[model samples]
Target chain A: MELQFKSELTISESGFLFDHSTGLTYTLNSTGQFIFRKIQDKQNAMHILNFVMQEFDVSEETAHKDLDDFVRQLKEFDLVSR
Target chain B: MTEKKAYSKPTIIRHSVGVQNKFGRPPATVPINRLDGFEVSELAEKYGSPLFVLSVKALRDRYRDLKRAFSTRYPNFQIAYSYKTNYLKSVCSILKQEGAWAEVVSGFEYDIARNIEVPGNQIVFNGPYKSHEELTRAFNDGAIVNLDNYDEMQVVEKVASELGKTLEVGIRINMDLNDPPWHKFGFNVEAGHAFEAVKRAEAGGKLKVVGLHIHTGTYVDDVTIYSRAAQGLVNFYSYIQEQLGVKLKYWDLGGGYASHNTLHGAYLPAEQTCPTFDQYAEAICPILMSGPFQAQDAPKLFIEPGRAIIDEPFSLITSVVSQKRLPSGQRGVLLDSGMNIMSSVQWYRYNFQSAQDSGTMLEDTIVYGGLCMNIDVLQASSSIPPVRRGDLLVIPHVGAYNISQSWQFIYLRPAIIAIEDGEVYVIKKAETRDYVQGFEDVPGKFITN
Candidate 1:
């Protein structure tokens, strides 16, 4: 799976995301921002979960659990593609 | 290391330029997670999605507040609970326990009043569609029927003659107060229909005209309309008394009290625009007290308070079923409830809130009900935080017409529970598919097909 959006999209340092294709805007939380950047940097699901596990002091099992739910949500919101 | 962070669904919302930003109004993201110490999420889980949760506290408080607002100002007054607005047995029982007369508008509602054991004398039947049998029962049982038309006046007389008793009844009066006269339901006060109707009742001898009733319209926001409507009724009251030499026993300013629910396409929230109980009281009490009735002969001021007493108490808790992306790239969440059960959604832009906060990022969202119809949209457009399937949403101010008018269409209506001080009372059990189909019969031809 990979994070996908139109090439004209813009993500500010403060986590303000703009979908240039649809002209919609969104603000991401700290975790959302980190995940989005990692996705944009072509990180896989395991890599993203590892990063979350390391930074958020969560067990690998919890990180994997949350990452699956979070990615499913990203797919629902059209922020990523399977 | 720091603690693990919470999760919020990834969301995108269309940012539009509007005058709303210039007004600096309060943001619409109000979190209503718990009610009467019960978590809304748990309520949906326990009672299935699309649950209607009514608050016994809010109902009692509103009844107390409205009664206090009027009774403290005037001596002769009664708050009749309008049965058509919300005739949930427990809802009506609460008001009746608080000393309210049941004001019904149909034979069905009249029967409901009777089934609840409210005495015929304590019921005020006020509708245009009373059947002959219903009229006979009302006349025989001594229920006050507000005569809606001249034909109804004849029906009352016939019933009274059959019962061999002179029946006391109220005449339904309608007048133009800048708004269109609802001409179909009652005798027009301006066109002398009301006056002539009274004379006929007087000459007919079997009917005793006892009250002047006027229900101008519903969701009446302007407080002055009550004064204007009351003044019209009072003038007509004086005219009837002077010409026919009969004094009215009551002056019923019928129901249509506006609650704080913002209408769709409305510029301001209804709380800011809707008149308060005090405002309505201030407008009409002085006039009713000073109206043509002599100080010694003042009639009991009757108001069928329905929406005003019931609307604030209930909240509909529906769960998000699925999320679909709209053409505008906004999330359209389909909830487990829709316009079929939530008829008020077809009229007002109901306040929908997340059961719990997800993020500070408010997005444009469209809320739809679980119905398979195209017209089942709840809130066509609103700003709200992220929500996903199986999450909870709460819609408030639905205790009025929504329940009474709801019919089982495609889906069965949900359970309705009344909460009081952390206690739950099941006012209505959730409808089931078997229950919906139980009354239906398959014709022979249809069964063969």
Candidate 2:
């Protein structure tokens, strides 16, 4: 099954995201917002991880952990399916 | 090439108005940042916001000041910290290190004191209501139980008779000291209730009267009020000794000392409004010494000070969640903390500071908590500098009663960090969703496979 980014994701200019499906709103920093946007663009987990690694100056292990934690949060809120 | 680029450059616009300082010198620069040479914003970035920070130096200094004041005045003075103020293990451990005995009002607090290894004799059990089991445990542990009323006196006597042991007890007496009277707890002196309780205890011969306890009220500003209270207790002590031939071992002036937190309607801050420990000792020592009872026969002085010793050293460091302009042209700054956690805000005009220098003038503003409830306001109308979202706000003088009284309503309580020796250590970790749900029982019938 192909997973598509839900239109319920509302993003403000200041990197605040409000998911209508789940009534939780989160304020993310610029870098966090960038990663979230990339994930929402129907990119695979590996592709999103690579993009984050290329964009930010961080170790591959750290990037993987951060992305995994972010995805786990989305999964917990039912914002994305594994 | 035909169309020449016409560029409109970005320009800085400054708003100016002809204004004078109507309410005195322009409100002093509201320090909207940094505390104890540490950036609050940086701390919030590393640890989450709504953080509690304790300064070991401030705590030590306040303790030292109180110790120096009482130790110099009376030859035998013992300070028992009221554990109900802030019973966080870290706080209690610090006080224990400073040679403070534990003054507990409940069995739970007594257990905490024992857990921290506070000597049984050092624990003074006080309060109006105590269960039979709690009394028996306290008595067996050799705690000095301060009996409040005649019913408690009978209960203690009955328990002592049953165990065939004479329990060491004290009677809390309420005396009219020319100040506002505290009628809720303790026996009344003028009404002869205290004398009656003492007489009954002496006649029963099962309970030994070892001390006399009195607490006037909290946030008392006048030193003379303490002196008056001491005088009243002295008069009673003299009467009891002369009539009943029993000498009290200690006189407990119960906890009511005010910390340097600004009161709700005080014109000056608490630092200026409340009397220092030295001043309080000066007022009380003379009255204690001037009585007919000398040091050898006079009861040892006991003070159960809670708020004054602990309030100034701790603070709540919260992040500014959002900022908005009210329809009435007032500014509102929302923070990550609320009255649920910072309960003292309901009675105190909490001082808020920024972590760093913003160099902005003060304006009338209201601060709100993260809760959606309108009643969760931290400050009603405060003169503060213009703040933007993400600015760090520091609420000082929150060490007393905040943690003990904090409730878990909406969001989880944040981590409490104790800053000692220029390093930050998490004394209490923030609560998580799993921690909150750990107590609930999910039955198999309610679960779907």
Candidate 3:
């Protein structure tokens, strides 16, 4: 089965996420939700990681590590593809 | 055959001052899990984010504490749950089960009290504006109707005369405290308005004066203020008895009790600043229990305490939507809940805590609600533990006013759940698209997209 990113993902201000394409919903923590929003802008992993680091006080190294793990989970759930 | 592994990645570790205590090193790790014994994450998952969870245990405990304080101090006293605080059926029902009579300000609240089966005489009708219909309903039900002004008195008299039934009424007397004065919602005693209202009710013959009611002001932490108020009421009561030969059956000190929730500009936490119920009783009960007052028929003491009773039991569980850095390097947390549900956000400095003990340092951040409005800020410059998207944030002491005063704007309000005996029951269902559209009228032309 081919997996493609769909614009059907709706992010609510309260951190609720729903993917109409898959009929599945997910909730993000404050940080996870922030990264998902950044990813929606179609930025590269490094650019997203940099954005997270600048916005949050987290170090670039920590941001990159957290972002990589988050991307892996998103891929596993078929929410995003490389 | 051996399966090939994925590419190796570096693990970035974040550091923060862990939950530490005095005497050096991190304190004994007290796990932040279930609040009041209800699992935080499980509640969020089941009820959906931005839900309101009320703890029956907290409500019962606070109610018992307040009741015991007055009942022990004063010989005769009755507590009426101020319905305006939170009229959620489940909340009111629990309070009714706890033996609290309903005290309502408007006809709507009166109807709710009636619907809940709180006896007619048990309901105290308060507030400045009472229509003829409302007065007739309350009078017919034998509810204690508190007259706010002379205009309302004439209306009551007219209604009672028309019905040919004498209705028991009370006059809300406003007295001048030491510095600040209560201007709205009562007849001023010093200005002779209260005396006039009392005289009119007595002469009407259709209205019987049975009670005297007064609510000094909101957020009153000083017991001395209430003592002064009680002294004023007692003096007024004595005057009425001596001049008009009328004895009241009850004296109502209206609701304004301060809950343990901190105020926006307070120097100390509310728990430390607010006077306990015992303190309040110690002040007012003596005046009622005094020798001269006791010599005559001691009236039943009625206290309508709303916020102090319900504020601590409820928590707003909201999911963190996003985190961003402001231009000034301040962290801003956007959550799913906003001013729509938590109306008290305008005046209260809500205490937000993490659901799980994530080993992150505390940072000062501005918490924003899901609403698109610029005024949707929930907390401006609050210190919260390092939080991320998907983390559940628990806002405590939101039992009062939030639900009763919530507004429906952009999004549907979440469900209200009551957790009791380790069981979760939905008292109110979350709103959905269909629920919003159910009332919307759509023309056929608008259906084409």
Clashes per candidate, residues 3 or more apart or on different chains: 0, 8, 13
TM-scores for chain A over all candidates: 0.83, 0.82, 0.87
Per-residue lDDT of candidate 2, residues B262-353 (tens digit): 78877666766678999999989878877667676667789999999889999898888876656554567899898889999878988777
Instruction: Report model 3's TM-score to 2 decimal places.
Output: 0.80
Interface RMSD of each: 4.8, 16.6, 15.1
DockQ of each: 0.23, 0.02, 0.03
Candidates in order have lDDT scores of: 0.81, 0.79, 0.80
- Please name the candidate that would achieve the greatest TM-score relative to the true structure: 1
Candidate 2 deviation (Cα RMSD) = 12.6
DockQ, structure candidate 3: 0.03
CA lDDT of B51 in candidate 1? Answer: 89
Summarize candidate 1's per-residue lDDT along B1-449 as a digit string, tens digits.
56666545444343466656443436667788998899888887788878899889988999999999999888888999999889999998888899999998888999899988999988898888898899888877778789898887887788877888888888888898745656766788788888888888889889888888888788888888889997887788878878898788898999888998877777888868888899999999888876775666689889988888888899989888877665555567888887888888866888778898766667677888888898888888877777766778888889988998898888888899999877898889999888888988888997784
Using DockQ as the yardstick, the better of models 2 and 3 is: 3
Residue range A1-82, candidate 3, lDDT tens digits:
2223555688889667777886677656667766777777777777776667666666665567557665655665667787
- TM-scores for all candidates? 0.89, 0.79, 0.80
Q: Predictions ranked by TM-score, top down?
A: 1, 3, 2
Worst window of 10 by summed lDDT in candidate 2 chain A: A69-78
Better of 1 and 3 by DockQ: 1
Candidate number of the best lDDT: 1
Query: Which of 1 and 2 is ahead in DockQ?
Result: 1
Cand. 2: chain B TM-score: 0.92
